[model samples]
Target chain A: MKTCYNCNRLNKDNDRYCRYCGKAIRNNSYYTGLKIGIVLGTLGIIIMLILYAIMYL
Target chain B: MKCIKCGAELEDVDNFCPECGELTAKGHRFFHDPSNLDILNNGKAVKLKKKFNAIISIFSLSVIIFALLMIFTGQNLMTPFGVIQKKINYYRYGYNTSLIKTNNKYNFKVNNYDEAIEFIKKDFSNQLYTCNQNKELTMLEYELESDYEIPSVVFCDMSLEEAHKIKDVIVRMYALFPNIKGNLTNITITNSKTGSDYVAYFQPAYQFVNVNKDIKENNKVNKTQILLNSYYFLNDNILSQDINEVLNNYYVEDATFESTIAHELGHYISFVAFLREKGVSNITLVTKDNEEEIKSLINEFENGEYLKNILEQALNNYNLKYNENLNLQSFAETISKYAGVKDKNGNLLYSETIAEAIHDYYLHNENAKKSSYEIVMVLKSKLKEVF
Candidate 1:
């Protein structure tokens, strides 16, 4: 699904225009990528802390 | 909701403002909120969300599992710094409070590695009774200590120096063969008396080999060897015997108590390697499902022609060099009495033969090495191949 920035309504993935707002619906994969980055970045920090404990503590 | 372009009230289902014909929000919540997104395009967006979640979940779970493996196995999982860390741990084994107390009591006057070894040698040399001469001696079982829940030896009746000598042996053994560290557990140092004729023996816990708790829990699918809960009984009277006496008795020259420990460890190492060669990935896993098959394979390897061929060829080499008339029986006897030992069917237990070769190599026994160089080289190459 794509969300129209102008009217903030969800649209069908194949539809270039929002069904409700009739505005252009841009692909929101960028938001998904940002979520993934946050998740992995948090995991990286946890692993680093574990490695630190094993080596030094 | 009100349209941004004009002040006109719109119903939730309305797509456009009635007054100005501007587009309405259509009751949509915040754009940043994922829960606010409606199921559109046949739930393709929800499917993508599930895929993203699955990927993240699997990755996070793998990292957690890897970390647990590293901790339980005391392995760094071959990270770049693992070797350095292992080297550090290798030196750290014998530096505990007990070792410090022993050094303080003995006033070892040690300056370096060689000097420390000299002190250890002096502590074990020319003691009370020779192993052969130990007749009608009392057998006193010492309480076992626990390290990582593994049963370690506690020196009850031993002088601090004697206890320290075996400690040195354990530390040196770990330094030499780090892989054999946790595998060698349940070390019981029988006090001062040679109650048993054997210097030391490794009682293989065949049962523990198949108990796959760790493998099952960790889900380790890799082919790895694990000798769990094996017993290594050490008779301290062996230390009292001179190196020459040990050679005369065992026929493997310079075979110190350390060599015997190495020999026992060699049994564990060789058994694991044999299982690996026989297509047994993990002993615990194999034994869990195919108990009979694993037993059959173990029996086959124990009495297999692979070791017999090595022995026969090594004996041939020895006989050719020294012009000695010795068959496999006599040749094995010459290697060590333990090597000549037979199983229930009277077939040669080649495990002992390989262990004797490892023992000789460990102590740098020149005579044994020269006589049985083939078997020794085989053992060395096998250890290299697996480890």
Candidate 2:
């Protein structure tokens, strides 16, 4: 289990960011969602293309 | 639209100018070096100005002079030729405008780059920092894509390393700076380059360790160890890889990738200060290789006058700050993007944003880390809670 260094708030160890405090649990300087957007968007496009190809072909 | 050299501005003509005898490519400045010619300004005007631009061409073309000089002169004439040109520029403008190439002096003059960083980190801690992503701060809040937490500030002192299944990558160059909680620093970092040690310093002590692009391409082993003084090697394959990439993104200029090595180093500076608060002195944290020496230093600080007070103050301050995390979340969100990212495993990525911010100040300004107190106040309010 992870705990807030400041408040002693118990948190899940696997959780990257905190739930109650919202601070980072392991790495504090992670980018929020810049590339996350690109990665997820790319995956979505690829999936949609595959589905479209299957339906049409 | 017509080629003069071939007279084919497209009319079945060859080797002849449509209107003038000048070769098509020869008449066009685009085909030639656009050195001192204000191409942008000239682009707006359809008609080209002067046939030969004297000033900028001299400035730009002379670079080739010394290179050719060495090849022909068959000696290290490039150095003397550079000196002569610099003197000419000085004589002409009463100032030297020639860029200094490869100055490794700052590393020696500033005393390991951390002192400049400490100046800001310590001051940032002394201020009443506020979390900025509040009600009016809605925009800054959106900037926070994500963040991970370090269990303790101790991770602040690890060596940044990115290890894949096959290889471990070490950054040849990195920066360090202080991250404040607010956006109101007294120190003003800028784009102007001025200073003696290197790139340019906004102030005396602070400087940005601009990415070192000096990679020797030969098999000649030129190695410089990034002493275990960094926090990149804490965990092995146990951290977030996303954080590592984000750190690299920070190196991207003006792309909304905010990062600075100093900001991450700021955390370490604060950690060092925190250690100092515990009455730790001369207790340098070295890598395992230097374990013996550092261990001796730590032993020296076993119990000092300020140790307990340091713990109390920091513990209390941390708790006070965490209580405000939710409200601080918005603030953390704004500055989070600018921060030098790290992975859950303690791998440092790219540059730390605050480090770069201050580095910009250090490189371009005269005051450098001079007014770190104000900078601390501004940064503290914006990032006191992020870590």
Candidate 3:
């Protein structure tokens, strides 16, 4: 079972969206996207920092 | 044709008499073929004169138009060398015309070639920071072509011979401007590929170190670092053993080591001039007292009003002279091919243009100086007033 944060409704674990609210339920794909986003964001920040250090070291 | 003084019996082809040397009427057409007499008889001689006159007139008119175009296009009749030759009567001396070479006294802060190498190793690292390219260099390979955003350093392994040559260059460069006693340092041999960038560059102090830090310990005065590509030091590329020849002579194919150094030094001089203009004194000092002020000033100078004013003035002068409405990039291209290096937004870098102008001013390349006169004048003023 999963809970939709938007509508506070309970749903089946396999369902991608809440039955009552039509809100997206946190799933494998969502976690994968979040992971990728965080990874990319962290990489971006690190690259920027390296550039800054190189320019003004 | 027969001689006037002594003609007797003369053939139609003869310029002098064969017998008594008496004048002959037929000899009046001295070298003209006898078969061409029909044209003269038909009044074509006068027509030929008219044709000749028309040709001359057309040529004259074309010349006048070309001269006008050259003038309007900011092409001066005199080159930088010609101008200086006229001013100083340089041609009379038969001496080397290079300003740096003729004045070189072999003075350096570092004692010897080995010492210079040691000093450089201590000051800068062998690790290239921004040069990310993987191109296989000839002697020492360099691949990165990034702009000013990253400090693209190249640390080439130098033989004692190469170090000696570089030491000679450094000594002469310093000798050229004694006033910049502590301003120029950290010269590193680089193989960093320069695509749109010049082969050599003068990086200012702020670019080398973090000026925004709290000045607790790193108060050492930072000087501009000169990065030169090792490609110029290759044996096949060397023009002459004489530094004078290296500095003054302009080659169409390759950049001479001395001239490239001069060009970077020109950048240093220009930067120093900028600092002086902004009222910064003792350019070496970076104490906690003036840290924030220095940081803001550098930021402002790089991206603020100071740079804007220079570009504005240069563009106005260029447009007015050429009678064309051109933006900074186009104007920079008009001045010199090398001067047209663009920034991230595609606008031309004013400092590169100025450095090229200063290079031409030193080399006496007239065509570049003709269009870059205004900026050259500003550089001259800076050299005079600031240095």
Native contacts recovered, in order, as a fraction for each? Answer: 0.05, 0.00, 0.00
Candidate 3 lDDT over B140-215, as tens digits, reads 3222212111122243333435544444544554554444444444555544433213346676763223333445
Q: Considering the two chains of model 3, state its CAPRI-style docking category.
A: incorrect
Best by lDDT: 1
TM-score of chain B of each: 0.44, 0.22, 0.47
**Model 1 segments more than 4 A misplaced:** A1-57, B1-160, B170-186, B189-194, B206-239, B242-248, B281-290, B304-306, B313-326, B341-348, B365-367
lDDT value, candidate 3, whole model: 0.49
Per-residue error (Å), model 3, residue B285: 3.2
Which residue pairs in candidate 1 have backbone atoms (N, alpha carbon, C) closer than 3 angstroms, thus clashing? none
Superposition-based RMSD of candidate 1 using all C-alpha atoms, in angstroms: 20.8
Ten-residue segment with the worst summed lDDT in candidate 3 chain B? B96-105
Candidate 1 structure quality by residue, lDDT tens digits, A1-57: 666654566654555555454444545665568467657756765665566565446
Task: Tell me the TM-score for chain B of model 3.
Answer: 0.47
Clashes by residue pair, model 3? B1-B14, B1-B27, B6-B21, B6-B22, B7-B21, B7-B22, B8-B21, B8-B22, B137-B141, B221-B284
Output DockQ, candidate 2. Answer: 0.01
Q: Give the Cα lDDT of each candidate.
A: 0.49, 0.30, 0.49
Tell me, by TM-score, which candidate is best. 3
